[model samples]
Target chain A: MGEEKGNVKWQMNQKCATIGFHANPGSKAVKTRVSLFVTCIVDQVFPQVGIAMTQVLERLGYPVDFPAAQTCCGQPAFNSGYPEEAGIVARHFLNTFRDSEYIVVPSGSCASMIVHHYTDIFANEQKTLEQARSIAPRVWEFSRFLIEVAGVEDVGASFDGVVTYHDSCHSLREMHIKEGPRRLLSKVQGLTLREMEPAEECCGFGGTFSVKFPEVSGGMARTKIESILKTEAGTVVSVDSSCLMQIQGAIDRARLPIRTMHLAEVLAGR
Target chain B: MTGQPSETINQTLGDARLQLAIYSATNRLMTHRAGAVRADLLPDYQELRTEANQLKKHTIEHLDHYLELFEKNVIAHGGKVVYCSDSQEVADFVLGLAKERGAHLIVKSKSMTTEEIHFNERLEKHGLEAVETDLGEYILQLAHQRPYHIVAPALHLTRYDVAEIFSKNLGVENEVVIEKQTKIARAALREKFLHADIGVTGANFLVADSGAVVVVENEGNARLTTSAPKIHITVAGIEKLIPRAQDLGVFLTLLGRSATGQPLTVYTSFLSGPRRNGEIDGPDEFYVVLLDNGRTKLLADPEKRQSLYCIRCGACLNHCPVYRKIGGHNYPWVYSGPIGAIITPQFHGVLKDPWLPFASSLCGACAEVCPVKIEIPKLLLKLRSEVTDAQRRQGVGGVERLAFGIWAWVMTHPRIYLMLARIGGIFLPLLPKVGPLGKWASQREVPKLAKTSFHQWWKAREVPK
Candidate 1:
């Protein structure tokens, strides 16, 4: 009973809405402004996805701004168990996006940092810890925010392809933005959405993990591509660009002719 | 990849390539799992995970009460429930029952719990033939190899491999086609299933309230394996027990979806006990052996207890990056993947497979996929600590201890660490082009050092105007 109370107390102190975790405004009224956190990977590798994300948010009447100097979410270090290094990176992130009302990211992995890691990231510094807790409630994945928060199902975009979506690990499992993406995808006109097999599994593209555990990553990618092939879809779509890139890398390696795209890209009607 | 450690088992699975092949297959399955979670599930999926976790926790906490109720119900329904404290006892009880019944042939289904006990070897010692009815198990039986993956047992074997095995073993000369291979195994196992006096199977969940054991499978082999035999013996870990039948809804919902990413398995068979008077096809005698086998010890430790919540869904195994590369044979146990890293140490004792826990990249993907929400990485770390503690007590080997002791000293002293890092930055790269160190750096590129260390850079940055 005491333990349960302690947990509840800790939870209550951490002022965050667990509902629609990847959503932006959610069902609750927002007094503060909101900005989009275009993740490092998207900023670097697929800038178009970032632009699509902004366009989508703009379409939803969201005043989305890219917080410059937001390098990475520090997940690379955090997941690697280098707490000290992760702290350094996290402190950098917090300082960069210190003024945002809500920090929404295109990637689930980055969103999870705000939701899951920030509290632990600022465990020592009391003031920063409060900021982390406050910031966590507003951290949203792009699709999650659109579907759950803005109540926008169709982005008024058109894409014609039998596109299948890959669920990134942190997004689907940690953030639980499963239905939000599909719900939005379901609204897209001229899109013949064929479901792929074994969809909830990881693509084995865990940031540094892909390089470090290359064989496992490759194997996971191969399987993902095989399933995509089974679906007979010309294009494989996923919310996380990292998963798409991983499967795409394998698809290229295997010399298979399947194209991979981000959810933003698909939703943006390309 | 590191070579397999020298141990009791000779030729630590001459199936590394085979395992690689199988892991490739599992990866495909994992991608499907990814798609399933992404496309089909709601954004509130974490809520489901929390609910599933709560359900499992609630079920585990009141397990004794449930077990008692389950046992009573099983007996009420004409099933004999045997709770064995250890694997050997469970084997003994089963062997004794088989002897009493004069059972000479036993057909088996895919059960990791039964595999854990080496029940086939035990039965074989008594001159009883145990035939695996599952297609994958049959393939492994022919190959003389253990299961590499949980969900797909002979997942390592290609259709060509299976065809070759069938041709050699069954005197058929057909080029390996998946259809032909599956048909052959189906035909071959069907004969064994009919003639077998008893059937041994694994339970997906042992419902405490109903005293029922449920088996979920894609292939219809389990159906035949259980009902065809006169006597049916269900072997399962004690942790498979859940509070009630109603709770099975959540588990069944998650199990197939999480495992193979299937909406539902083809067969979800629920067997309460022996056949009733009016029943047409069912076992005459039903035996549920609840094997504790070090799980009680695990259950006692709050930190490690979540290992018990695992439903053997194989989601962790399928998604594990390390398991993909190294495969199951490296673990030195029947169970492999993230669950294996935690449970193998507990069941086989932490002293064995000291390297198993470190096999993980700490990705937390396993915990993500776990239907019951077992925090496998944490348990792996706990087991690693246990292994370290055990090694410290046992007084580790001379060279290993010496190396670690030096490492420990270097780690504690920042001065020594900096000095070594500096020296390493300078001369380590210079001396690495020749000799033993060259061999170490052969396939690997050492990271290029900055002109100044991070500490040095930090100090310079702090020197503000």
Candidate 2:
């Protein structure tokens, strides 16, 4: 509510500022095709997550396009401060999904990379910067698309388990996605939503940070794993695969019975 | 800071007691802050942050004008203003003043500016006795440690640690009781306040309109530290200026809550100058030392000048996960956590303190809790790029650049990327646990690649287009 005074515009254009996150369901075309930018991690390491996301989107009566040319959102490079490398990769991403009606990303961080970091990457290039901004408003994280864009609370999906939702940082802060995801989870049949104390806390899979500052990152993961254990939830669900990757790694190492699932995979359940 | 961030992090992780102390202290502070700044308690908190941000930004943008106005007002009120380019000059000025006045003993309140310049050590080296009056600072001064946390300088210590330090330094009983330790420090410092010839403090807000150095503190020690001595010296950063006295309402509301979760600190002193004629109490001579120390370089950069907007609230340190893991001694500067991460590199130049910005996970917690609404994560990211650029100039990071370059090439070519993915699905599970992968595998198991990738499955299945 407090805007900048004295015309200097000190806003400085925060990269994570919500560009076009709000959904007006009635004003948008329902038949407009949606493209899935399955993040590199999801595409290679955890493909079932991508499959699950595709199943849910197509079931909702929207044609989902897989832009084969889309390799990555360049988050790994961007977060590691290799922005020039990120720009090279990000420019390709902008081109691949150029004409797509609705670009939906399964991972929160990847979607954030497109909506936020892409503008920064193309800042010096006027033409590409315009393209990046034009495409940013249309990009949506998977769960947000299901709730806000599709206006569907229950996707007629069911999963039997006590699962806590991990609010991945990019989706929570960048996409302003909090209760929207919880609201969707609550509607899932047979799913008992057990909330963890540190649900909003990071699992410490900060791209290269997991390796660069592994001890600190691992320490955070251990703390998060304990929080999940305290909840006594059978399964952990999150919007991003990257967070699950970190949690899953720790859960496996600790030999804990806790299984990590993508929110889409849970929603895609029978 | 005892060592490099990684080195200290490794060392601290092994010390379970120290880790627990840091966690408990920071956790308690976080709980207090959350309750203090809730919407019901402070309804206009967000707007106040914006107003403070705007006010600070305007003042700093026209800092030359405000500095002139502030200096004029201070002089009119019979105070002397000396601008110091660096810590060396600040130390030189204090030493000169002490020698001229024949002041042997000097008492100080909690002043991070003084800590930054190592003022006490500098004075002590020159055979002048400078005693820290704040309980936390006093404990640190005795233990021969630097200020660890912003609000709680001895935050990493426990009652037992305090007992040990007190027993070793002050020859007191090994008192494990909290109140007893406070009394022990209090008893020792009260004598210094009376006998001290000079008192020093750091200003919270330097009001340009009236030239009042506003200090907000919970301890009544600042009142004694500034008033007990005949000479009161205030060492503050040049960026601490605000345009008007009326603007204190906006900052005062946020400062206490953000710093220590108090509605307002116990004492909020607004001192302009020396005592007027017929005044019963106040300093005979007042001096305000405005220290630059690389602040002008930060101010010159339009994108990152908001680092100056920090009010040293310590909210960022309390909420930062990285800070919570590694603790304060890991940060190699007077400031720690998000503020330290950004400022340390900018002040010392990236070449010297290159590791700080990369210390964060870019979690955005610091920015969320900031009283002045400084975009800390963004600044960290910006500094990271600067560090990387500096590294590149030094001909380092060639391998990393080449790896990213190859990654970019492979990523742009869809066929090669997918082809590599198919091959990765087979061999990824067997990847040797070494380097980054080994570091990641230290605590967490490496993930096995999915049997059939989503891309391959999508192409195999012919859905209605």
Candidate 3:
């Protein structure tokens, strides 16, 4: 059992470094190390996003680490009004990445949950609240980390297509990530970045809101799709996969030929 | 009335005509409001909002003092102040006044507070005629329906619907044209206004220092409703007081611009008391009924008293995406949209309809557009927690609690988290499309799970040279 557990940890480290994350082979020296918090949705549904994020960061000369103990940021429970359950998962998350210098998440919603809401979840416990506050400032969403922290606008990426970006509500409203994704997308060669009408409005995924109020959710998705179609962009890109899922779901149902892609995937290039 | 918000929403969603009506009306209002608040009309809109918020905060905090001052000032200004603890008391007071004055007909302008008290229904039950003189309210009164939108009571009705209601109720024909319909309603309500024995109206703002009941409107109906009658009864909630008359400048500037994108409403009447001794065409007796039906309950909660800061601009409603989709009738209240979502649960309790708070997408649009900057999304979340706590106390939400409990446990353990994902990937496609999953899949296709998760793919891949 011990050997198996050790092997799993080793494999996770190997996985972290698979996408050219190491600057020098077997060399422990690097400018920075980032712990990847591949939010649960991207981890399971759109793993390419995680891969694309890793590749982009690795290319930026940062050694990335995927802590095997990291599971989720507990946004699902937190947003669903189960703060106690959210606290349990949040404390575990805080413990897992407690020692990391920089923690990066590919999802704006999850990143925001950690940065903005973790303190509220751990409000009853003073030590945990301080821990959350300390962890809060260090946590950055993928594109934001790329632009603000790493100070890289262009990642040597190229994608040939007309694309529009949806401002995920959490990212736009909570994290103020309006221009980061667009700035990066603008630098990509051969990519025509079209602006969709009401681009800042929500796609209405809203976590469990899609299932809880399916009709309203579906209605909002249709409204967003109509806005996307108006842009005449072949692909709809957003930083949050949860939003992309809702948009893609509506597009598929409508049988529209429009495609959805994560910002990381677009930046990682074809 | 309770626990049927979803049912009402579903019914409204099914009616495409009503949906279109609500969508276009609110869209127009939102666009107009946005244009009205631009630098040209109000360059320092944000500053004004902040000051307005501060004034409201101060007033609400010392609400008892301000209310007493307002009552004293009103009484000193020759107006009678009657304090009502509930809707019944308000109706009783109004009926008693009407009986003492030997009044039969009452003309009212748009007042959401009156709608809240069901004043018209109560008056009718007591054999008194209460006519809604505002065109939208007039149409709704004829149709026997509540106001659909806060600002636009007949917003859910199309010109055709109004024409139909007129033809059926008023024996008017060929008034399909919008202008002609307005003419028909104006002609019908003109006599009612002249013959009105008592004009009942709702106060938009009560100036405590000067004893002024400020009424803002466009149709001039409120002006007529307050004047042109022997007895003018102004029913207002105590939360509407501002400390001084000058405060109206900040509020008035924001109110019309946020409400309908107009720089100033056409008629802004300040009725301090009954007409002065020499004044012509003003009521002889003025009574201000201060209703505190569940308002003090909210005022007592320090965290939530900011809800009282609402100026009833309806800007949040116009800009709200959910309100645009589901419309006002789904809320089933005199006040609807984001403000309704917060206030309804607070006043009526979460058990009334546990879903009202969750009905919103929490997009924060409401907060962004709120003239007074009520943190609506936060309040919604707070109310949601209250609802969850209530559910917990009643031994409800067991299944959801269990699911979240298991989810929390799994998410804390990475090994189990990944294992469950892998298993779900293999079996989610095979699981029958039923229950909550089915509901999600019904309208939109569920995303297909990746064959190899990023971790698995990364772990098995060769390192770059």
- Best candidate per DockQ, number? 2
Candidate 3: tens digits of C-alpha lDDT, residues B16-128 = 89888988898899889989988776789999989999999999999989998998999998999999999999889888888988889999999999999899999999999
How much of the true A–B contact set does each candidate keep? 0.05, 0.72, 0.66
What interface RMSD does every candidate have?
9.7, 1.9, 1.9
Pairs that collide in candidate 3 are none
Task: For residue B110, give model 3's deviation from the true position in Å.
Answer: 0.2
Residue A34, candidate 2: alpha-carbon lDDT: 85
Can you tell me the CAPRI class of model 1?
Answer: incorrect
DockQ of every candidate structure: 0.07, 0.51, 0.46
Report, to 2 decimal places, the DockQ of model 2.
Answer: 0.51
lDDT of 1 at B36: 67
lDDT of 1 by residue, A1-270 (tens): 422434764344234433333223333233224576776556545666777776777655666555544556666545543444556666666777777766778888788877887786577889878877877777778887776566678788888878888877778767887788887888888887788876776676665445534445555566677778889988887788777767776776667778887888778874
Candidate number 3, chain A TM-score:
0.88
| Model 1 lDDT tens row, B20-92 | 5855687678767766667446455566677778877876777788788889999999999998987788768
lDDT of 2 by residue, A153-243 (tens): 8888898879988888888876778897788889999999989986778888888888888889899999899899998999999999999
User: Could you tell me how far off, in angstroms, the CA of residue B54 lies in candidate 1 after the best superposition?
Assistant: 1.5
**Candidate 3 positional error at B416, Å:** 1.3
Which candidate number maximizes TM-score?
2
Can you tell me which runs of candidate 1 are displaced by over 4 Å? A1-270, B1-20, B39-44, B397-424, B431-442, B453-464
